[model samples]
Target: MTATSISPKSSPDRLSLSELEAYIRTIDTSEYTKTRNYIGGSTQLSEYISRGMISLPRIRELVLEKNSFSASFKFLNELAWREYWQLTWTAIGDDIFDYIRPIKDTVRPAMPEAVINAHTGIVALDAGIRQLQTTGFIDNHMRMWLAGLVCQVAKCDWKVGAAWMHSYLIDGDYASNHLSWQWVAGSYTGKPYLPQQDNINTYTESLQKDTYLDQGYGEIASMEIPEILLETVDVLPAHEATLPEDTVTLDGLNELKNADTILLYSPWTLDPLWRKQDKAIRVLLIDPDVFSNGRFSQQVIDSIVWFAGQVADLKIICEPVKNLEVLTAAIIRKSYPGITTWPGIVDEPEMLFPEVPVAFYPSFSSYWKQIKKYSMTDQQSLF
Candidate 1:
């Protein structure tokens, strides 16, 4: 395939670390993840930071001296989440494998062929799946749909779905992918997150075909998505906000904007792009690369890369699991420096970003109880 065929239709402007580091300093904490996803990746920014495109200590100092507590602490919270998961892995040691298996193997399979063929008649999903197979990205909302289908409708094992998703998603990571799959399958937090067929139809608005409706894909009932049990909202303490000494907010948004303004993930989310600050540049973020031999269609991967690249100029797009705490801290510190990064804010920081409110649902308490009991008693172990 031509290079264009495998990439997003548009090209994103390359970013530098100084640009992103600057962007991180000024952005609202609640918008961190969303904005990061929009900006895309920071490999380039990482390179600059490593090469002294900007000084870390300088940025840290600037945050402190200005008493820009919100920005400083928010950025720190983002960093902290990343650290937490990393530590969780170390603490659990071999237990992670044990915990993951039950979560992966518990579900039952209901619609194997429909899932495989992308014939479910839900347009956005079919498109998303095709994109997954072709390129590897299915936006956050679409990801929930696919995961829900694997858990509730297909009733397949979470491992199978995760494996399928991982094989293609460019952004896939073990912690986020596995935990997310488990959460949907009732293994993580313990409640299954099954979307009603109608929900899919409504959300995607692509099921005009009567075949799916007649086959009962449309009338299915909804399963409640579970809630997470957090210890305290303060995942990180304010004392940890270590801003480099020289970090400075840019005078204006430009390619010359400070090194901290780099985009970490998707760029489309930046209102300026939508407003046509750089229409051609923004258009380039759409991946022209369209096909691949993988299970996901090329479109998905390209879109993800495109979005990530475009936004990378402003943030750091990392494996959600890798930098979760840092991202979380960044948001918390950015939103409320005085709140004390506790469980309340850490878990539901969504409240800070009104655009992305906390999406509440049922908990997996019952499921975990049953599964744990079965695992200890009658359940057959599988390799």
Candidate 2:
């Protein structure tokens, strides 16, 4: 499909890698940790990072170049958390949807209707949900609060809530999204994250009180599921778009048929500069199965299509990677559990601590300790 086919309405703000870098340079990390808990206090660079328009290594390098590590450590830590989740996902695979550890409390099998309808009576949370539905964006703190409300207070299954959230998120990554939900559900962490009314008030700047969340931690732990959250609702499955019948032919496919390398760009790896010097067939493969299961919104799909347009001679393929086995060799950026058919080269994500162990670390503290050991001594690289 042509880039012109993707309507601007279906895409979020479209920024090229250079434009994204300019935006990144403008981020003020001085007060990030102190103000990040409040809505609109974040850098809002997640969509670019998640979509691979900007890499983690580049972000870390850029931030460090502008500010001292001490000043930007919190922001860098946040970037590292994304890497930690990805490494954890690589270790566990599909098991991330299941409980990593036994849950201590009851969890409803289905999602609550109140959450789906955005009428949970929690003003800050409902506002966040509405923002998510409209713009496919939400701050991290609101995300935790929403997750806590859905998986802990609402008592819904974490997977169910996670899938609902993933459907609309422009920055949704299975590892980060699912694992965070599990963390809130007490499946990945030692305890479920329960946000009290005061906590919400402090972060959201709302004077809301007397809600079900307005209670002591002990009282909240012992409280029964609110009547509003007692009933479950069926979340309508995300609509899948029809793929093009024929893949677009690249300009050099015939001449490069005998070439030893082919760069494959999936939704996860749309890097414009990947293997630019090599004479290879560059294909943007969009597997129907991947999108079907991913349930990505039209906006996210549009953004992907737009990003793929940036690369010269990049052919868009609608079928699975397995169909392209005729290619001499394939190279791709490592992604989720699936998308592994004939991987000639799997490039690891550019991480701050590339040498850190990949085994699942139960807590970010455990993972961060290992990261700090290497990040402190490593020389920084700029994009």
Question: Which pairs clash (backbone N, Cα, C closer than 3 Å) in model 2?
Answer: none
What overall lDDT, based on C-alpha atoms, would model 2 receive against the true structure?
0.75
CA lDDT of every candidate: 0.39, 0.75
For model 2, residues 1-383, the per-residue Cα lDDT tens digits are 22112212223457766777887787778878789889989988887777776788888777766787677867887887888888888776788888899886777778888887889999999999899887788999898988988887877888899988988888878888999998888888777898789999998999998999999988887788999988897655554544433534454445346656667777767777776787866777787667755477775676567777666677666665566666655455445444555465776567656777778788998886766565554533211
Cα TM-score of candidate 2:
0.87
- lDDT value, candidate 1, whole model: 0.39
| TM-score of predicted structure 1 | 0.41
Best by TM-score: 2
lDDT of 1 by residue, 47-129 (tens): 22221223333444434454444544544433333223323333343343233435434344332445556755566667777
Candidate with the greatest lDDT versus the true structure: 2
